[model samples]
Target: MSKLSTYVHVPMENRITVTLLCCASFVCIESLRKNWRPALTHLSNGLRIIESLPMSMLNKLRDTVSIYGSANNTEEELGMDYILRLFATWEVSCALFAENFKPVISVKLYRGRELDDKPLDEFESITQAHRAIVQYTRDIFALVWLFRDHQGDDQFWSQPIPRRQHEILSHRGDCMGGLFERFMAKPQAPPSGTGEHYSLQWLPPTVYPNLIASLGIEGRFKLWAEDPSAAPGRRFSASNRATTSKAAYEMRSAKYPYRSFSMKHNEETRHTYLALLASDGRLMVFENEQPENMSEYTPIDELSICTKPSRGEEVSFKVRFDPNPDPCYNAMQAGVANDSLALVVAGMAAVKIYRSRDVITTSYGVAQTQREFYLALEVGVHRGLVRDVAWAPGNIRGHDIIATACQDGFVRVFRIDTPHSSNEGKSWSTSELPRYENHQVQTCSRAGQLNDKQQHQSGLSASLAKSGSHAERHFSGQLGQVKHACKEIAKLDSHRTPVWRVGFDDDGQILASTGDDGKLVCYRQTPSGDWAKSSELAIVKTRMATP
Candidate 1:
């Protein structure tokens, strides 16, 4: 084996010798167990040599022999099938756990149309278990490649898994799950008459956890189906104006070319807010009446997402409404309320988060809502174009995690820890006015018997004048209130291709991504509080021989 490692780069004409060396190296590595490091080196070298050979030659060799030599088979043909199986095992083993290893041998030897084109049961030559392991691992390798190629693809990750890819991941995951179930459900030993023998439940060994972790690919199909974003967002078209014909609001601005727009609904206020991304790098915010009533939209405030005008025309932006508002905002003048929300915008290679506070200004004899979005955190990783940005749901951790898929083929996660503030425990009271119904406006403490000056000061006059007026609040005011400390918790480049889309699981625990490479990769936070790669799946396309 030691000598074979040195001669791994030998001429390709010596295929038989190379194959024998690879089989021997793999056998030695398994037998030596504790002292397998040197054997592994030999195996890696020999496998690389075999991987470099043409698929045609390997196929010819495989077809000439069976698992056991037949009467018609010559000495050269004996054990060829077993040798190929050894190569396949090594390829999968390297991909799952080995360092800096890829599955070149498997790809070269696979005669199927594509790993994802068939279910495990469709394979005829191998046992069900063997078939599942081989096909799934190879499919995962293809998935990783796809993920790398399409790292910046939004549709791949955010939307429903493509039909072909979906079938592959789903089928493989089911196969693996069944295998585990069968293994655990093995028949128990027959009870002895004399002694009471309990049927012990079968459990996988501890080493299986690491191996089973890769089975996450099986659940990905179900996860994608459960994702809210799996269904495409409602589309609005000006040409076919039946649904959106009645304009909620229109900003006739030739001066500021609106690059993109995002809308977020506040459950507390039951009002929808619109954010228009201006090419000038500023965001224009507008307030709407209610969820059902969308006929009117009033311009509220505008803020900058970027310090300077971005040269790139492509922009991606999303808005998130924080459930908890800073208790400090609850004290802003009686009857006036503040809302906490955040705007994440990306252009070029930069992603900026703006913490916004919608302040209900009750001045000029009318109550109105105004928003102020301040730049809170910025991530300027030298990664290429920022393709997509996702803000995970639920803030149980008392912080926000923003995931970005960049053209440089990295899915980076940033953690923003801000002060923990809530308006849950606080209470508000109402006072009656002569002309209007008793308005229960959100106030700090001043309850009853207010003079005219106090009425205007407490914003009771505006509440009295307007019908169904409420505050749309987001990130509190004071520039320093927003956390500037953005920690990059994870920077994953396993895809090795431009990532186009990123999305979070419901609980914000798992993050999945897809790229132009046609692969999907998932990451999850471990109990140790570190983000690690969980699983991978890919759409493998293969070339057919010309008829």
Candidate 2:
């Protein structure tokens, strides 16, 4: 048994309304036999949940599994982790997949060409370049609609077309038209120079293969694929054995290099995006590819799925952080903002910040994301790894506050007090490494940006980097690696064990940090605007072993 809340006060059979609203709804027309109460109840319950601005039910559930995952916590010791995921995933996932029910607002994709008038039956063939997908959040409850090819009906699983009915009609080898297998092959990078253009519309993509896996059955069209009857002429895989084929999807959904932390919900504007950081030293940005949603800036509450999406070249929004000077990190953290928004990502020993070129006047503002990234600071906390980073909300104050958790058993607060540069298309200068002794202090400043003279020197160094292993071996044997540090406003060394996470609520008023001690410490801003310890929550209760 676990801690659970019974939030649904009304019975599933109760209707939301039976009067004037019925004229516009099909449910009202069909109200003769079926009880629309459950659906309405869900609608009411969902709004209540969204008011708190929580992560997607899917991500929150994933968070629990993350805490107890093989690489993180033990199931026996962290039984609590299963509680939240179990309840949330069951409720939301069930409603999402419920017969005739929808959770996603819609998903539209860009294939880099004019699309066929009819909705696509399946993903663009392995040969076509599939570049982006748009996600729209509907104003209604949890349900969402999707049109993969930008020219279809609202329904995803069926109605407009059921492509999943037979994605793989024939079997040739180990893969039955495994679309994901092809995804592993690096598609040519989006044609260069289009960098700034695409950056204006979307964020840097994450490792796509793993993201596909996380989509579950919906990802690779497994809904009907698993059913032998769905495709009568084709034979199912041997392991599929009469509808017990979850193994196909289970094997595909392994850990993504950059897992999601949080995303602005549909109630938020289309410009708000999904923020993720990779353990492998990359920041991934995802935004709706909607052409129409691109034009509006509705408050979070009024925002919903776009009724239409387009297949045009001149669409999207963006940013860029120079390839890592050292590019190594144990974990990562990221935060997103609105109105001339600012994005900050940090990990290992580095912290990078990106700003929109200007505030968006319209509803959708992904276009504001710039390819130019400001290397705000480099952090080196006693040569320790950073566990987490967070930004406090304040357009008035311009998001200067940051909180970070570190392996050094401390939670640090940092302020972005510098006028950083826009280092677009600039690779960190590897040529000047040997010129300085304290690499941390040496490479962490604005001087690191490459000007004309430095660019020439960088060319020689970059040439060496591109040169074969022999050149790398020669350079490695001669010059050493550089270290860097970003300044912090304050450091709180309260935890005895390594601090694992740190964050600020939407308001800059409260700050919280969690650690291996199984305790959560919270700090609140004072009347005078100073953060002070306010509360401590015990995650793992002191318990005796059972027989």
lDDT of every predicted structure (CA atoms): 0.54, 0.36
Model 1 residue runs over 4 Å out of place are 1-257, 307-338, 358-369, 420-484, 542-547
Candidate 1 RMSD to the real structure: 20.0
Write the residue-wise lDDT of candidate 1 on 255-370 in tens digits: 65555555555544556566666555566677765443344666655655554545644544433333232213222211123355566777557787766543344454454443
- The residue-by-residue lDDT of candidate 2 on 295-341, one tens digit each, is 12222111101112233211111112211221221101111111223
The model with the greatest TM-score is 1
Q: Give the 10-residue window scoring lowest on summed lDDT in candidate 1.
A: 217-226
TM-score of each: 0.43, 0.33
